[model samples]
Target: MNYTLHQLQVFLKVTETKSITKAAEQLYLTQPAVSIQLRNFQDQFDIPLTEVVGRQLYVTEFGMEIARAAQNILNEVQAINYKTMAYKGKLSGKLSITSVSTGKYVIPFLLADFLKQHTEVELVLDVTNKNRVVRSLENNEVDFALVSLFPDLSVQSIPLMENQLVLVANRDFPMPKKPLTLEAIQALPLIYREAGSGSRFVMERFLNQLDSKGTKKMELTGNEAVKQAIMAGLGCSIMPVIGIKNELQNGDVQIIPAEGLPQSSQWNMIWMKSKNLSPVAEAYKNYLLENKSTIIQNHFGWTEQL
Candidate 1:
């Protein structure tokens, strides 16, 4: 049987308020009209939905179950209409984005060009560490998040770029004539990002693979903090090459080689699988994929494996 959109909307409203009078007031319809629609809905299903206990109208158990299914069906129908409208290239809306701290250095630059092309679209960006970014995505707090390490989530992930993790030390610090392996680096005092930051996880996993537990470390929150600590001769630490571009160039820090480090680590753009994305967000995602390498080269002066 066919159900009208208005019927679904009215049904959801009544379920939300649990009172037909309140639902009718909210929907701007008379109480009898609301009751008639509800009864018609139940008739279509060959079942009764409401019962009277004294003067109060209460939902039947069957009605509660049907209300749950109605929500899903209504949502799917709305999704189809939204996507149909988006596919016609009528892109005009706001895009909300959240990203890990290092992504601040990358995503904003990419978005700038995207904004220039789509001048009418509004953009909102939030830059936080990995934990906050993940929590925001989980709570529907942001449309998309750029992260260096993949989050432990059941979200849709688009592989955007790969960043190399490198060991950096102050240029003035003493270094051995030979390259250091994971085992050798673990012996040195290390400055690192907080637990949830992607760089820390990558470095720690690399150390773990080499039989080092990674207990010889000091935790710093931001990229600048770790960079400054290393520049102050706080000992060497593994950091994202993307974050240390200027420091590496200005002779403030040195990139040291480590054995068994992966050639590069993968970074992903992620969002909740079940969430609906606006046309503007979908357009920006397309823009990022189309200009992935250029985005990296322009931001960090280095080519990225897209």
Candidate 2:
């Protein structure tokens, strides 16, 4: 009962990261300071909030319950702050967003104009695989998430632009003069994104539809790694066209012509439908919807696709 919001924040950060050191770094406090606040918080509750077993921290069931309540309190406080700012016609707050790895190629450009206009706003961008991004959105850990695949239908999504997945290989790799069948392409050694990647999900679905079990050459972590592996002649991969534009133009990699290739999917901006949007987030959502088409066309020269 004697705990302060700062203590709760420390506790929450510790629980989220499972490391006192990491929580301290994130909060810009000393490790001892974080430890002190956590100790005080647990003392107030007179309960063991966390336990470390074999060097890994685990939150107790009671700790999880309190953490949830703490998050709710923090959300309410943030909402109140946003409401006050809205009354003053000010748009200034931290905007937390997570995106699938390939979204790194597009989201920065999409947000450039908005960031310029809202000079006082700060951004926290987390680029990760689709699975983690979706999990974060489900937990209400971020305000927005950009993804190519829609895994959960419960969350509201706004379609932003189209993403094309193209088969790419090292420039020196042998290429057929004519388009190859899906089965032929599947027979080639394929560099693939790791599990939980949106690209991997799409690629798996495409391969399943062809009734072909593709040969996996290697499983890499991110798009950049996959591109590097392919360019080194490790194998071919299906990559987002947007992420490969430079390599495609520079002759470092070439798109392979194939039947039933170039899988098409849309990039979507998503958020939890049950959560109340802060004024800043609502403004950003409107901004993205209003300017999406023009932005994509102007930046990527995909006007015809629209």
Candidate 3:
């Protein structure tokens, strides 16, 4: 009962890292300071929260239960702070969004005006692969997920804009001497986004529909890595033009003109339908729905030429 939030924070960090030394480094405190706080916190509990065996720190089962409760307390404290700010007439709260890696190209532009209007809002964006982004949404770890692919999940969507995927290769790659055939294009070295990527899923589906089950010569985790690989002439890949606009314009890469190329999908903002949106989340959702037309016109209208 005498424990402070800082002690709880220190204790939680220790539990997470399983080492007071690491926790101190992460928390930016000296080892002795962390040890003092940890000792002080454990004194409040009836049972020992942590133990050392063979130089390794371990949190006891009671420690885990305490840590869970501590997390809830911290979450409540954050919620109270957000509420206090709202009452002062400045739209403020944490706005956490996870986007598939390629979405880095688009989400920020969409967020600019809204954030400008509500400067007090805290923004946390995680740009990872689609699978991770969806996992965050499934666990309700994020308020919204920006994705181009809508898979089998219980989620609602707000259509934002068109996404264009095109076949591209290093600018120095030899132009096919004749009009390209799917087989001929498939014969060339090809790179792919790693498995579990939304872009890869779409690309694979598009290729399957064409009956061209081409094997990738190499696979990379992100758009930037794949871009660099292909630009280094490792192979060609079907990449979102959103991610490759600079390369496309700079002539570092060239689009491979082929039939059924430039596959299209819509980038959407999706969230769990069963969950209630917080004030900040709801406000952002409405802002996106209301301004998507302008956003698309300004940011993505160039995809039309492809």
lDDT leader = 3
Instruction: Indicate the residue-level lDDT of 101 in model 2.
Output: 93
lDDT of 1: 0.78
Candidate 3 ranges with C-alpha deviation above 4 Å: 13-36, 51-58, 176-179, 210-212
The window of 10 residues in a row where model 2 has the poorest summed lDDT is 297-306
Candidate 3: pairs in clash: none
Using TM-score as the measure, name the better of candidate 2 and candidate 3.
3
Off by over 4 Å in 2: 1-4, 40-73, 302-306
Point to the candidate with the largest TM-score. Answer: 3
lDDT of 3 by residue, 40-133 (tens): 9998888989999999999999999999999899889889988899889888888999998899999899899999999999998998887788
Q: Which stretches of candidate 1 lie over 4 Å from their true place?
A: 1-90, 210-212, 215-217, 297-306
Ordered by TM-score, highest first, the candidates read 3, 2, 1
Per-residue error for 131 in candidate 3, Å, reads: 2.4
TM-score of each prediction:
0.67, 0.86, 0.89
The TM-score between candidate 1 and the true structure equals: 0.67
Clashing pairs in 1: none
lDDT by residue (tens digit), candidate 1, 133-208: 8888888868898887777788887786677788788998676788786677788888878888888887787777
lDDT of all predictions, in order shown? 0.78, 0.86, 0.88
